[model samples]
Target: MSRRYHRKSRQFMIGDTLTIPQDKPDIEFLLRMTAVPTIDKATGADKKVIFSGHVLVTIEYVACVPDGTQPIHFVSFEQPFTGAISHRSARPDRSIHLKGLMEVQELQLVGPRQVKTSLQLKVCSVKLVRCRSPLPTHAGEA
Candidate 1:
């Protein structure tokens, strides 16, 4: 006999544009992200996933040195992101959750010491409830 179960999943996406802090001039910036999961609320078979995370922004620039040469400088900043994903399932207690992935779509140097960035994110929502069929009865057992 083979065992089986039921599973359901859905995917959601979001996009946004943001500006870098104008603290210093930057030649380039790289982004790295990680997802932090949070449950927003639960009501009548509906729930909200608070998709939040931190972005590591690595900035590279040129600095003037006393020897009449320029040295490259590197700096990092941790930025936070927050969004909500709505989902509905029959059972919210048995392994129902959301997973998020992020990507930087575009980054441009818009002005001196400023940059415009665009991001795209995908959220996968999964719900695994109880088994669909009943278990087989053993011989001589009720």
Candidate 2:
């Protein structure tokens, strides 16, 4: 029998964070990666160093509110994402943080009865924080 690619009605969101897991398919999910500079070292002065690396972005899900009672710290937590990355060398357990605009390639389904789903996302958020980004506090907090 021939297989068909029909994406289920999944929820994908876009924000400063990666939402969905690496095993979910969402629409409009992405994170574009790029390199930028920061005023870390100023002629010998110690400054806040900015990190630019590749980030794995995926829209897991969205939590909408009837009333607009959102907080600043709660914004990035709403729309979540998971950053996928590739390291340069000698780095076995690390990957560059992704920062930029995430692009939504398309939704893909694996099985007929919806075995699994995958979303094509591009990382597009600035590498503000460099860490594993645990699922607990990882969503959208880029």
lDDT tens per residue, model 1, 1-142: 4231122222333333434455543444334323222333212244554444544445555643456556566655544555555545444343434444453334555554555544454444443344454333211100
- Residue-by-residue lDDT tens digits, candidate 2, 27-110: 232223221111111111122222222223222322223454432111111222433332222132332232234334232333
Candidate 1 differs from the real structure by a C-alpha RMSD in angstroms, to one decimal, of 11.7
Model 2, C-alpha of 142: deviation from truth (Å): 14
Report lDDT (CA) for all predictions: 0.42, 0.27
Residue 26, model 2: Cα distance from true site in angstroms: 24
Candidate 1 similarity to native, TM-score: 0.46
Q: What lDDT does candidate 1 reach at residue 129?
A: 46
Cα distance off (Å), candidate 2, residue 51:
12
Candidate RMSDs in order:
11.7, 17.2
TM-score of 2: 0.20
- In model 1, the Cα lDDT at residue 134 comes to 33
